[model samples]
Target: MNITKDLVPSIAYQVRTQEGVLVDEAPVNQPLEYLHGHNNLVEGLEKALEGKAVGDVFEVRVKPEEGYGEYNDNMVQRVPKDVFMGVDELEVVCVLLRTRI
Candidate 1:
């Protein structure tokens, strides 16, 4: 059966930074089956393929504002070293905080 827009599974796609580096790849090689037009995929990519078919190689480049929100320092926080009473491996960034938790 030829894959159409509606009947096709939620297509799986890969994303990579434009800097000649592999940023991310799909978890699986098989296409993921999901209903479309339901915020199933990223807005930019989905919008580009509003009426596309399977085996069609399309490209959608989304900026930080669209693809994923800008990196916020708030995502990361620093706590006192003593707070970790008994944690063997507490890692922040690349630093290894060896404490007993």
Candidate 2:
């Protein structure tokens, strides 16, 4: 079967820098799994995996916009300490993500 939207695909992957320095990879027996066509994987990887069948292996170059997007300091928002009231061990320069149920 080919990968498509809403379908969970398992993949063994390796990441490297432009000079081919090792960055990250799936564990020896643990592959990454995610629903295809969702915003789970990077835009470039998702596009490359589209229509691919099992055991397909290939390489792709994801630009900043497609991978992580160009970082913008303007996008950062600062919340007051009171917003995290009752939370213990809060640290400076940390990221907090709010998830929707």
Candidate 3:
């Protein structure tokens, strides 16, 4: 059966960076299953997989805009280390304190 909206799809995928660095992967024996057209998968990926059938192997390049709505440079900032006092492992604490712009 072809993949369509409202239908569940099991896909074996390998995600890589533009530079070819391996980011994530799903084995063929253990495909990632998700509901189609339900925002369960990335927008670009779901759109690319639409109408595809079983055993179909293809590649898709999802731009930042389609994948994560683009990166906002204004959302990033540098903070002082002193702000994280009492945290023994600073690297393990990946918290972003939001502030009103």
Model 1 alpha-carbon drift over 4 Å, by segment: 1-12, 27-29, 77-101
Q: Could you tell me how far off, in angstroms, the CA of residue 15 lies in candidate 3 after the best superposition? A: 0.7
Candidate 3 has a TM-score of 0.70
lDDT agreement with native, every candidate? 0.52, 0.68, 0.69
Candidate 2 lDDT, tens digit per residue, 10-79?
8777776555655567753687888889789778778878888876767777766777777688987888
**Reference-based TM-score of each model:** 0.54, 0.65, 0.70
Question: Which regions in candidate 3 have their CA more than 4 angstroms from the true location?
Answer: 76-101
Model 3, 1-101: lDDT tens digits are: 99888998788877665556555677777777888999986677778888988878677877666677666778878788888888766542221111110
State candidate 2's TM-score: 0.65
How many pairs in model 3 have backbone atoms within 3 A of each other, for residues 3 or more apart or on separate chains, i.e. clashes?
Answer: 0
lDDT of 2 at 83: 89
lDDT of 1 by residue, 1-101 (tens): 43335554556555554443444444446645655567665655556656666556656665555445677888867788789888767653221111100
